[model samples]
Target: MRKLGCKPAVTRHNQPRLSGLRMMARKAPARLVRDHIDPAPLMLANDQIGDCTSVGIANHLRATASLAGYQIDVSTGDAVRFYSESTGYRPANAESDQGGIEVDVLGIAGRDGYHLDHGTYYPLWGTVDPQDRNALALVVAGMGCAYLGVQLAAADQAPGVWDTDRTGDNTPGSWGGHCLLLWDYTGLGDNDLVTLLTWGVRQKATWQWLHSRIMEAHGIIWPQMVLPSGFYPTGPDLDMLKADNAAFLMGNLWQVPVTS
Candidate 1:
C-alpha cells in the first residue's frame, strides 16, 4: 500500500544507491523495482501469488496453443463473476477476485489425452492464496483428467515450525506444489499409470509419489478433503461454463481436461 504525499529520490541504473534509511524503512523506489515485476505493475501482492492478471495468462496460452495447431479456446477466468444483474444470479462470491489461468482450447471436448494447450512456468503467477470469493474452485468427476486441489496450510504446517507428523508437507522431495492420484490405471507395468499437478507440499506427479513426498517433508499428510477441488473431465452444471470466464478459478485447484 503506497501512501499519499510520499516521494523518494529518483534513481539511475548506472549507479547502485546505498542507504541506511532505506534499510530501516525497507522501501525501494518505484523506478527501481518496477521493471523487476512480471507482466506489469500494481499486479503483485494485491492478489494472491497465483492471482495474476488474466491478460498475461491469455496471451501465453493463446500463442502456445496456436503454435501447436490445436483447436483451443482460452477462458482464463472464474465462472462466478460472469453473473447477470437482471437474471437469477447474485453479485456475491467467496472467491471472486481469484485471477485467471490459461485455457488451451476453449469449448473442446477433452477426455482421453491432451497436449499442452497454453501456459508457462511463472512462479509468481502460480502461487495460490485464497481471495475469498475471488479465488476459484472446480469439479469434474467420473472422467479421465487429472484432479487438483488447493487448501490453506494448517497453522502448524508452515516452514521452520511444525510437529513431527503434522508439521511439513505431503510430498517428500518436492516443494512449490503437491498432488494426489485418486486412481492410477493408465501408465506402466503393474503400476497404475497416472499422475497429477498439485501445489500443497509438492508439485505435479502421481498420487502415491506425491503423498510419500509430503509425508517425508512435513511428517504428515493433510487430511483429504481439506484442499479445494481442482479439476475434472466433466464440468459443473452451470450455463456459464459455455460462455466466458465465469468459472471463478483463482488459486483453488483445477484439472487438465479429459473430454473423452
Candidate 2:
C-alpha cells in the first residue's frame, strides 16, 4: 500500500485551463463495460511520480465528458497544482514523489468546473463500499466510473498484467499510497474483475484483490451525464426480487387472482 506523502515545493509552471463550454447530455447506451467503452478518445493517466491522484481525477473527468459526446483532456500538472492549492501541500519536487488525497482532487473539480468541448461536468460525492461488490457495481453501472485509493503490494504493481489473488498479508513495504480510476466491472460472483484506468492503460483486478487491497473508494457522480439506457440488476437487486416473488407465492395470491 502506498502511504500518502507531499511533494516538496518547487517553481510552478503554467498549465491549460478548463474551457467554460457546456454541451447537452445525450442518452447513454443500454449497457457498458471495459470493451463497450472505446479507449481511443479517452485521455490516459500517465505513469508519473506523486501524481496518481491527479491522473485518476483527470481520467474520470475525461471519461464523463467523452460519454456525453465531448472531448476534454484535463492537464495532470494543473490537477497537481489544484491539489497543492486545496490541501496546502507543496508541488512535487520530482516525478517519483508520492502525494495527494481524493477529497482535494474532487475539490478542484468542484471549484474550477470540469469543462469540455460540449459541456461542463459536475460531480456528486458518494461513498464507496468496496466490501459490497453489488454496491460498487451499481455505482459503476449507473455512474460510469468510481475513484479508488488502494494499497498496492509488489504483486499488485506488475505492469500490463491482471492483478489477482492478493491477500492481506502482503504489506505495502516501500510502496506509498496511490489512487486510480475504476471504469468498469465484469463477470459476477467470485469471478468478478474490476477494470481500472491506471498508468495510461486499463488494468484488471479480481474482487478478492480489490476487497483486500482497497483502503478507500469514492464514486464520482456526474449529474450532467446520462445513466445507462437499460437496467442491470445487481446482486442485491436480484436478491430482493427473489424475496418478493417468494413472499407473493407463499401468500397463494396466484390461486385467488382472477378479478379482472
Candidate 3:
C-alpha cells in the first residue's frame, strides 16, 4: 500500500473564503493541464515517508511554475525537509512521522514562507468548499490549481478513474487520509472529469468521486503565478486577500509580499 500523509482538515477560526471574491474569468476551460508536461510522477519521497502533504505542495509549485513558461526544480530532499520542519517529523524518530494537517501546513507556510531552489515563496491559500464545483473550477482557472485533502477508500488503491466503488471497500477513510493536486477538468455538468497529480503520476477521477471523498480544498496563489502588482494574473484582488489574510492569521502574517 502507498503511504498516506494528510492527517485531517482542521477548521480555522477566521480563514478567508473565496465565495464573495469577483473572478476575472467566470468560466474555466474544460482542461488546465498542459500537454507538454510529462505525466511521470515525481513521488517526491512519498514512497518512503508519509509526506504527501508537503509533496502535494511541491508538486503544485512545480506545476504552476511549468505552466507559467518557467521551471522550478524541486527535489525529494526539499519536500522531506519541509515535511520535517512543518510536522515535527524526524528521520530517525518513527513516532514523529505521523503525517500532517493540510490547512495547518499551508497556514504555516503562508506565514513563514516555503524555501525552494529559486528562493522563498510565500503562497497565499484560502479555504474552499469541496461541495462547490463552480468555485473549484474558478480556482483552477484563476489560481492555476487547487490543493485537496481526501479520504481514501480501499478500492482507491487500484487507481484508474477513481469513481464510486459500490461493490467493494468503498467506505471513506477506510484506507487513510491522503492529499493531491487537482490541476485539470474536462467534460461538463455532473459528468465532469478531473485530473489529479499524486503518488508520482497523473490520475483521472470522476467529479462524483471527488465530491464524495474530498474533505477539504484550498485555493493557493503562488507568488510567481501572480502579476508584479501582487495580484493574480487572472485579475483577482490578491493584494486585498493578502491583506485580509495578514489580519486573519497571526501578527502581520503577510506584512510584506515576497517578490523574489
Candidate 4:
C-alpha cells in the first residue's frame, strides 16, 4: 500500500512509552458510556483517495468537541482540504494521494482552529506510543478518544475483524498502513478490546491485536473544559498547575507563597 507523504519516520525517542504507573481498570456502565461521545454524527462516509489520516483526525477533533459541549461538523472533504493545504500534498496526484500523517493534520487543526458554531476553537495534544492498555483506557474514559495507526493485512481489512487469533505476524511489511480512531475500550490486560471508527462503522479488536499490528498509536489530549464528569486530572496536569503556582508566587507581582 502507498504511504502518506507526510508520514514521519518512526524513531525511538518519539515513540509512545507506557507510563509504568499502575491504574485500576474500571468499566464505565453501559448507560453512562452511551451518554459519552456518540460516533454516529462524526463518522466519515468516504474519504478521498488516500485521506484516511485526515478523516481519522477530523473525526477525533469533532468527537472531542462534542464531548466539550461544542458541536463541530467536519466532513471528509474538509479534512482532505486541510491536509492538502497544511502538508503541501496535492490531492490531484494519484501517486501522492496518501494522507495518514498525524502531525500534519494536528498542526492544521491547531493553526487554523477547528470550526465551531460559536466561532471559537481549541487545540489538542498528540501522544504516540506502542500498545498500552491502561493508558488507552484512561484516555478514553477521561478524555474523548484515541487515534491509532496500524499495519493491516487484507483479511484484517475485510470483515474488519481485528482479533488477535486472526494472525501471528503484524509487522509493518506484513500489512498495509492505515489510520483509525479508538472511541471505546473495555476489560483489562489480555482481555482488553478497543472500538475503532473507520469507513463510517465501528470495529472491535483486542489490545493484543493492537500490540501486534500498531506501528504507531496516538492519544489526542482533550481540553480541560471538555473532560468528562468523573475524570480525574492526570499527573502532568497537576504538575503543571503546581509549577505555574510556584512561579507566580516567586514573581514580584505575587510575593505571597502558596500555603496549600
- What's the lDDT for all of these models? 0.22, 0.51, 0.76, 0.54
* Model 3 CA deviation exceeding 4 Å by range: 30-33, 36-41, 227-236, 251-260
Candidate 1 Cα errors over 4 Å, as ranges: 1-69, 75-142, 150-168, 171-193, 197-203, 209-260
Instruction: Tell me, by TM-score, which candidate is best.
Output: 3
Tens digit of per-residue lDDT, candidate 4, span 53-148: 666766776667677667567755566565555445464465545554554455445446555344534444445345556566665665566677
TM-scores, all models, native as reference? 0.22, 0.63, 0.87, 0.69
* Model 3 lDDT at residue 174: 93
- Could you give the C-alpha RMSD of every candidate to the true structure, in order shown? 22.3, 16.8, 5.1, 9.8
Report the Cα lDDT for candidate 1: 0.22
Question: After best superposition, candidate 2 residue 101: deviation in angstroms?
Answer: 2.1
In Å, residue 8's CA in model 3 sits off its true spot by 1.8
**Model 4 spans > 4 angstroms off:** 1-37, 41-47, 65-70, 115-120, 167-173, 222-225, 232-260
Model 4: lDDT of residue 98:
50
Which regions of candidate 2 are displaced past 4 Å? 1-32, 39-46, 89-98, 111-121, 164-169, 172-174, 227-260
Q: What is the number of backbone collisions in each predicted candidate, taken in the order shown?
A: 51, 11, 2, 2
- The full ranking of all candidates by TM-score, starting with the best, is 3, 4, 2, 1
Query: How close to the true structure is residue 161 of candidate 4, measured as C-alpha lDDT?
Result: 61
> What are the per-residue Cα lDDT tens digits for candidate 2 across 98-184?
365555455455545555444555554444455656556655655567677777666655544444554333564235566777777
